[model samples]
Target: MATVADGHHPFAFTFGILGNLVSTMVYLAPVPTFYRIYRKKSTEGFHSVPYLVAMFSSMLWLYYATLKKNAMLLITINSFGSFAEMIYIVIFVVYAPKDARKLTVKLFGIMNVGLFTSIIVVSHFLVSRAYRVPVLGWINVAISTSVFAAPLSIVAQVIRTRSVEFMPFRLSFFLTLSAVMWFAYGLFLKDICVAIPNVLGFVLGLLQMLLYAMYRNRKQVIIEDHEKKLPAATPDHVKNLVIIATLAASEVHPVEAQPNNRNDDGDVNNNAAITEANEHEQTDDHRHVENASVEIQPNETPSAV
Candidate 1:
């Protein structure tokens, strides 16, 4: 019995080599974030799913490489990938909250250990080496496809909040670029397994960038709305007048209040007295209102009046 040679072209080989280098760089890009987590002693709001999926992808690729002849590049890159992702996961677990740490441990058990062992056992016992390669290739395809779906949660968040604060543009840009490089490499190498998932990755990356652009300005708008809703304080003149009126009323009053007289000449002296009293009362009320307004402004200074 004879085995078929995996097709390889020079262009495809070169592309694959380049793609691997670029992918390695991108994979290591999370170093700064992990460093922060290490320093802070907390994972904050960061999720562990990306690192988990990345580890799973690397593991799948490594399995596929074992089945394929002359897959040195694949094995090399994915080995680095496995180490990087494991380190990220470890950092996350160290800094994550109790519930998050528990969840991450469970995920590692289910995905990395249990599921991976099952695949290895089944593939080794049931399949020949030649068939093993193809089976693992398809498995890699499946894992990568699922990885592409992970960004949907972020997309939904962006839509709901109308904010792209969590979705960094540089990340989307690099992801899309990495996907393109990998896709080209896979296409040249005639490896449909590698090319297909990257197509989805590229599309998702583009969508994320677009969403980021759309909602980047929304933060300013939200701040402006808050500013518009705040109340303006009363002017100083009213406050001063009220204080003066209250002081005058308390300190200087005529011994007897003058009475208004209305005669047949239609001169109503009482009306004048009533009007003057009403004016004085209104002046006091205005001062009281202004004083209340000033008091409500927590950090205001009297000099501001």
Candidate 2:
């Protein structure tokens, strides 16, 4: 357990501390998320896969930090992450419905308990002591890289939805800052395992921030408010009346044709003729309607009685 001061590169040590601070904030970013879940008393369609994977990643990193020397920063941040992810999982399980709870528990058992135990046993028993750290470091690297890439789903969502509602700028900003800090710390610490994943993290974080900026105001799917309901279908009589009125009015005030219009051999005149035909049709329909109403009247009127 070498302190940051004990290391030859004090800059690396300082960066590690900074990384720890930033990473801690990144880890705590989900507190509000979980709180919302808690207050709602339901998982509200939010999947538990993320927390499960995060816990798994933290566990893997924790194991790696324990094996590697002078990786106290890795040890600390991952430790915090492991604890935080666990609490989040617990909250999720409690609020989740029966099917979700079952699925979550199954994944935790397979990934965290069963799969994790298998990794420990295989690495411990089969791998040599000298190669153990390297093997684990590479494995951790792979997992960390994947964890960083998990945000790509959100990126795709942001792009497809053109909305930044689910992808908060603050979260992306902190993730980017954490990535920068951790990368610097790992660079100083001279641990490739710690350095590699943060490289990807930094890139993804920047991409998320870019997406947030590009789409903060613009969305792919515009959910224009349909507060005003569509007008009901026009009644047949009403439609006829409107059509008749429009036709009669147009015929009364027909537009004068220009020389170019007259060149087409009564092209403008055709419109006026059409309006006259429409008016005739409407007058015929109105007369038929009046006749039908008269036919369907009561046998005797009140004045006649």
Candidate 3:
């Protein structure tokens, strides 16, 4: 459905401008995330799939805009998107850890280079010019829908972890608002392909916001409660034995020491006692009490467990 004739409607132009504004915000929403990656010098768990898919989507839209008339808005915004996503990809490649970098590079080659090139070739050579716009537009619709639904994984994470940290309210709000703006734009332009995906976008965005509300105050308390461990219970018998040992230890008096000597038969002779804290000196106020333990000389023999 080439909308060359109907696309110039005044209402369409107005909504298109609004769509451009909101969509630009949507495109740039990941700026802070990339900034974090840059500062930390690691990608952490953030995947390159979303940005790569987005870049491919924008490239597809750029080609679609080229084929259609009155598509300047598409061209202008997608040009900015293309540049922004490229910068993010470059930053990711630079700071990502070794394994993450390798995976990201592989995905980049496959999605942004190889797959995109194939689409371009097929659109230009195999597909007839008349059907090009429609075919490409549908492809974009599919990709856009996937982009909107990509947060399903995040939603699951939020639910499982009982924390809203995974989903940002500002991004969700912008996504929903952007959906509304673009939906109106496409509605005014009589372009169903543009209008269709935003319906899903708006719905999914609302779902995310509602989830944020439900668990925002909880702050992962539910999961943490389950993860927390209570102190192990002490047996009554163990407690009684500890009490007896402590009393017995507290009542003990100092023992006198005898000087070492060698017997006339040439055997070593010594006197020892089970006594000592870190050192072996007993005074009027001195006390050694560590689980009722006492140091014994090696010749005195070891204690049984």
Candidate 1, residue 112: Cα displacement in angstroms equals 0.5
TM-score of each: 0.68, 0.71, 0.70
TM-score of 2: 0.71
- Model 1 per-residue lDDT tens digits across residues 1-99: 001132365665566667677777778778887887899897765667667867887898988876776566677788999999998999889889999
Worst 10-residue stretch by lDDT in candidate 2? 248-257
In angstroms, how far off is 201's CA in candidate 3?
A: 0.1
Stretches off by above 4 angstroms in model 2 are 1-6, 219-221, 225-305
Model 1 scores a C-alpha lDDT of 0.72
lDDT of each: 0.72, 0.73, 0.70
Model 3 per-residue lDDT tens digits across residues 76-138: 778888888888888988987798789889998998899889988998999998998899899
Q: For residue 75, give model 2's deviation from the true position in Å.
A: 1.3
Question: Residue 275 of candidate 2: its Cα lDDT?
Answer: 96
lDDT of 3 at 99: 86
lDDT, model 2, position 76:
83
- Compare candidates 2 and 3 on TM-score and give the better one: 2
Q: Which stretches of candidate 3 lie over 4 Å from their true place?
A: 1-7, 229-305
